[model samples]
Target: MPILEDLKEYVERATGLRRPGKRKVSDLARARKPHAVRFKDDGLVPNHPRWPLIIYRGAFEFDERHDPAAVIEDLFEANGWGDTWRDGIYDYVHYHSRIHEVLGIARGKGRVRFGGKKGRIFTLKAGDVAVLPAGTGHQCLSADDDFLVVGAYPPAGTYDECTTIEDRPRALMPIPKVPPPRKDPVYGTSGPLSKLWKKAK
Candidate 1:
């Protein structure tokens, strides 16, 4: 079923056609301070050394009139992030070696561990968004029955998942080389991501 869903998503993205409905992609976002944290390499995870993981709490204020998942997709697409997918976080620790990622909480709530075994655990509810730089490890600690996450990536890099110590050698090369997204998935050029990431570089 998951494979079928992924194929459908790929087709949708390839065709540039989203699920049809009256989408409210207007002003549903809230201006919030982005909380950023840097994580070190745990030998296995090879987390990004320079870029910090950014969290935007209550980034969007959603109501019954809006589909939270669709709202996230719209916002991400508008900001030049593509290849959107909807699913829950993985149970085991994993990182994307070649590209940065943004995860938006669209339904229920979840607790995720960022970085590796030494990373911090965050409780994310609906409307929260987390932007992870390349090679940042993430694992799902817990989630509600209805928990759902909307994830997307920038057009700069290819997507590859790394989970084992053996993958570290191959992952390290591209971790730091991955280019930062020009716009925040939730906010455009004026968002904190622009200045924060720029200053870090």
Candidate 2:
């Protein structure tokens, strides 16, 4: 079923049907302080030491007239995050050792575990966005059948998936070195991310 879903997404993307908007628009619903959480290196998942994962609740808004997923993709693109994709989170625990990631909930709700086995679990709904620093483990625990998420990466680092204890040793060196995203996916240069990340550094 996952493979078939992947194929359907591929076809939609290839035909440019997945994104129907060609113009830039501002649809941010509200501005609020982001909820930041830090997870320690849980032995297996070398969570970032300096940066805390950021969660922006109800960061964007859409109505029946608009396509929420496309709006999320456009916002990320406008803020300099690229390599956008539309899909559900991987069901198993995993992480990116070399790059940071941002996920914007587009159409449904889900329970996701952040960090590793000892990490926290959060419920994410449409309009919510989560920004993950490199080495931060995450997994989708459960979701509604209509759940959809839009993901993107900052331009600064290489994307690498690490899921085993065997990958831990090599993952350490790059976890702290990965550059912070130039702009927050939800806000531009002046966003809280710029200040918070710089302060952490």
Count of clashes, each model:
0, 0
lDDT (Cα) of model 1: 0.86
Q: Per-residue lDDT tens digits of candidate 2, residues 51-164?
A: 999999999867665467777887888889999887899998899999999999988899999999999999999999999999999999999998989899999999999999
CA RMSD of each candidate after superposition: 3.4, 2.6
Residue 155, candidate 2: Cα error in Å is: 0.7
Each candidate structure's TM-score, on Cα atoms with residue i matched to residue i, is 0.89, 0.89
**Model 2: CA > 4 A from native:** 1-23
Report the C-alpha lDDT of model 1 over 68-155, residue by residue, as the tens digit. 6767888888888888888899999999999999999988899999999999999999999999999999999999988888899999
User: Can you give the lDDT of residue 36 in candidate 1?
Assistant: 94
TM for candidate 1 is 0.89
Candidate 1 stretches with Cα past 4 Å from truth are 1-26
Q: Return the lDDT, model 2, position 44.
A: 95
Worst lDDT 10-window in candidate 2: 20-29
